[model samples]
Target: MTRLLFAALLAAIPLTAPAAPSDPYPSTYAPVPSPPVLIRNATVLTGSGERLDNADVLMQDGKIAAVGAGLTAPANAQVIDGTGRWVTPGIIDVHSHLGVYPSPGVNAHNDGNEMTSPTTPEVWAEHSITPQDPGFGTALAGGVTTMQLLPGSANLIGGRGVTVRNVYANTYQGMKFPGAPWGVKMACGENPKRVYGGKGSAPSTRMGNVAGYRADFIAAQDYMRAWDKYNAGDKKGDPPSRDLAKETLMGVLKGEILVHIHCYRADEMAIMLDLAKEFGFRISAFHHGVEAYKIADRLAAEGVCGALWADWWGFKMESLDGIQENIALVDRPEKGCAIVHSDSSEGIQRLNQEAAKVMGNARRVNIDIPPERAIRWLTQNPARALGIGDRTGTLAPGKMADVVLWNGTPFSVYAKAEKVFMDGALMYDRGDKSRQPVSDFMLGQEAAP
Candidate 1:
């Protein structure tokens, strides 16, 4: 029966549609403009372990043109007085379900999880995202300039995740982070078993969960072979047509997409690692890896990042053994694998505080995680995980002007996002608190302010 269903789905894909012409210069390719803005007299945390106190950052044509002290602002350039403020690259949440599970706190807006089946490789999170869902404003207020909105882990192969800029736009396309590759949200252990078994599906157990993933990946492998043959102009007989679902999976096989697995247990993490080895693709990061410390060395050797909560644990059976030292342990200098992630709306707003807490706890145990290295958990590391490092992760020359200025020590709980700039444009300024984005749904509501 499952084979018949799979064959039916495969047959539904169109085999002979004319291919669209590719653009030589895609929309993301924009010309660099002269200096448009300058931020002066600030403490710059470059996300590369370099800090420049009383420094100046020059923005030209939507990129960081230069960074130094005593830099001259171009004539007619917008000068942001960053006196006494700390500037850092905008925060990047590698694991977020903001838009897919968007708010007004309604079940109708909850699109993150497709729990009906254990394998849902066809579903894409972008299509389910509501751009003006008001969460974008909250993320921006928290200095989150770029975030990956992933599908929830209700299935073995949930869906492809979309990376988007935290900007106000009419459509998701406008908010989409150009040139950022999509991610496949895969899961292991309890989530798949629980979600599918509850529905009386084939994957009601751990072994069943593994079987489900293997089956889909095997199908994806065959799907890619068909497409490769078609792309090679071997249309002698009726060529297998394009399947959006299989196309996404094929993208993973071709290394065009990243895999972000949500696994909690160490044994399951090792299993997934072995599975990745067998499948010949890398697992970019382990999201909600509370037990990551147990396998930090292996993860670091594989260059797989561990995206974890600072101190969250004990909310469920799987996360029972989660420790606050997870991040610190994974971040050991010898191991070199850790990223602080906020899987909640509230947590996203205070990611810095989360990192701070992790650092503090690590220090108490004599694990000296410097603030500079800790910042990477929320910045450079995530950007690399999302494949957007070139554009916005650091305040490097030719990178996007996505920057955040804090009112106090970013690691301090008292600190707040004072100003945020994207593409050299001022999007938020707390001093002029009136400029913050208030969603249409939030407008005229009594509790909005």
Candidate 2:
């Protein structure tokens, strides 16, 4: 009778979802079908600091079958003469606002920041993604295969950032990367202070920012303890009420979600690092860290990556000390993870050129950043920072065949991506008008040619 009564009580209480949802807004991405192909006699930058001249790349069954010299093509493969071209893994932009703050920028499209509160971790950047934002096609034309779409830096704990494939889809879910982890966006330095300060808020100063983080994390800790107790069967009462913001924070505490913070000053980054230590969460990368060079060695030792612009600076006080050699300096440490990222849509179209600018600056300092090594800023390092390093960054056997055929050395201003492939499928061709993807939003709006 006691067992029967307990079963009835359990049935009367609502069943709560698991701590981590397995498929809430799950990815529905599907790679475009492709066939075997071979590109012979090209200069290949493997994206792992290895360059091979007169090499051949094989693509079959939606993966990089092989990369070598004097390799024979399969009988059914379409052969291409890569005589004067260069091949590199497709570019991956670690910082981007492509869909959230999409093109034809207007008041209606301004959905990036949920500024009603300072700590709104419940919000998600993917919810604002408009797949028909013409930016995707333009980015693809520039050889970008994957990108992390993030929220604007307006709040202390802004929201969740999503990693997505630069592919055309009717819905953002179809563009989401299947197994990519979510990133929580946090900001430090000027933006948050200035924003809330003018509004007569608590976090009008840097200390206030630190306090805000601590308070929220403390609440999250309590929330986690409640759930943990229930899961461990230590609590006989009903399971604790779920808080979306706390759930997101608990994901960070559990190392399920990556932390990407927007910080400019070195001291503030150090403070953030200390805060992470207090909360027991890991930071994946620091975005737009102009002062990252000041603590390059420490960041390398901690295994944190710096996703920064090549030369952008001086527009704001925090960015005033930024130098052109920032990327190179941050990359000086033995284990330094440096990535060149485009936070602007216009810059996203010329990420290779941005890396070239860094290369030029590094050369002036006698840093000697070669093409092979510099390519890591665009490919491997960004992939590692975004938690997709094992799958898509380098051209390796069994990896995604995201390759770009450049008309010349990619570092040169004259170079262009002649052909762009994602998962062995030809997604863009510079010479083929039909192959160019036009967004549905741009269909009838294109000016007459």
Candidate 3:
């Protein structure tokens, strides 16, 4: 009787186990198809100065598999009808402080500068990156797929900066640009001196600034010698205890890292070039080179790229002589050594417009820089500076599918980013106006539609 009662109760209650609690939002995002995606009937800018009209581009497994006209998609491929739009490789910013100085604009959030000392080669910028910063989304909206988040120029040897993908993610490691070489942020002239001098430090003058750099590099050279002896099995005992600062500097000496120096004046830039020669290290690029036009030929001869602002000058003593023809003069046909850059959060959003302004200035000065070449300032040139040229900057087969589709000519004042893709994934699509990636922190805080 008892067995029968138990069996009856079990049968009366639900025999099927209660449905396990699931995520109300089960991973609905579909995986990228293997056969690839086909974008048809669009204008393609190959980043090699080649433009294709009514072109077809295919992306497979996160890479550009094919690009041309009259190409057919695979049977199971996803298709995007690009009736009328301009497609170009994703924009790269060699000098950016996005994650380090993330948005929400708070003093507590500032992480780009380790101003505790005038030389902090021990620090690493990637360690300070806040991947969940809202500014990542803003940069994505502007079609910036990859960027190098650099440490500030507050010190002579600021530290190592890291390059990262502008993917919406929760961890910095998840967004790090795979295999991108780290960069050392070195500064010259006013910034370091001013930062330290005001605080009653050694570098109170320009000469002092140079001395500080020389001293650090000299020490770095000695540090390298120690490491070399240890590595070559010539030195015994303790292996010269690991020094993070010297490790970073040795990376530069070994050519495993790139050097990005920030300077404003022409003479200071020349001094930095000489310093590079003295130290036997390459000067990858000069950031905020407002006076680069004054010695554009020298910069080109040294194989150094100048990152400048379009029409940004006269705000400081060093930039008093700045002119609109800066980009034009540096980008002269015989001396192609100029690139427009945006160090400001707002300016970064419209790098295309900044390049356009430089183009306009160049045209006015009778310098016939083609629109394609000017576009290089925001795309190809920066990729070269950041050392990711072969990967994401160009729309070539076997390259990552970092592409941007514009509503109009990217140079136009009214042009806007219509769609953006990173690694064959549709990260931003204005066509789907309803779907936008917002951080968890912004979920209910933002006003609803």
Which residue pairs clash in candidate 1? 14-241, 15-241
Residue 251 CA displacement from its true place in model 3, Å: 0.8
Badly placed stretches (over 4 Å) of model 3 are 1-35, 234-236, 332-335, 433-435, 447-449
Give one digit per residue, the lDDT tens place, for model 3 in 180-247.
77899998877888899999997989999899888888888999998888878856666887788888
CA lDDT, every model vs. true structure: 0.81, 0.90, 0.79
Which residue pairs come into collision in candidate 2?
none
Off by over 4 Å in 2: 1-21, 234-236, 447-449
For candidate 2, write residues 358-431 as lDDT tens digits: 99998997888889999999999999999999999999999999999999899988879999998898888899
lDDT of 1 by residue, 1-449 (tens): 12233234324533322212321212121222234888899988898778889999988777888999999888989898888888899999998888787787787897888776678888888888886677778888899988999999888889999888776554566567767788999998787788778877778899998888788888889988877787688567787876766777788878889999999989899999898888788889999988998999988888999989999888888888898889988875754768889988878988999999998998898888776778888898899898888877888999988889898679998989988888776777776645576665565666645
Clashes (backbone N, CA, C under 3 Å), per candidate, total: 2, 0, 0
Query: How does candidate 2 score on lDDT?
Result: 0.90
The residue-level lDDT of candidate 2 at 414 comes to 85
- Candidate numbers, best lDDT first, in rank order: 2, 1, 3
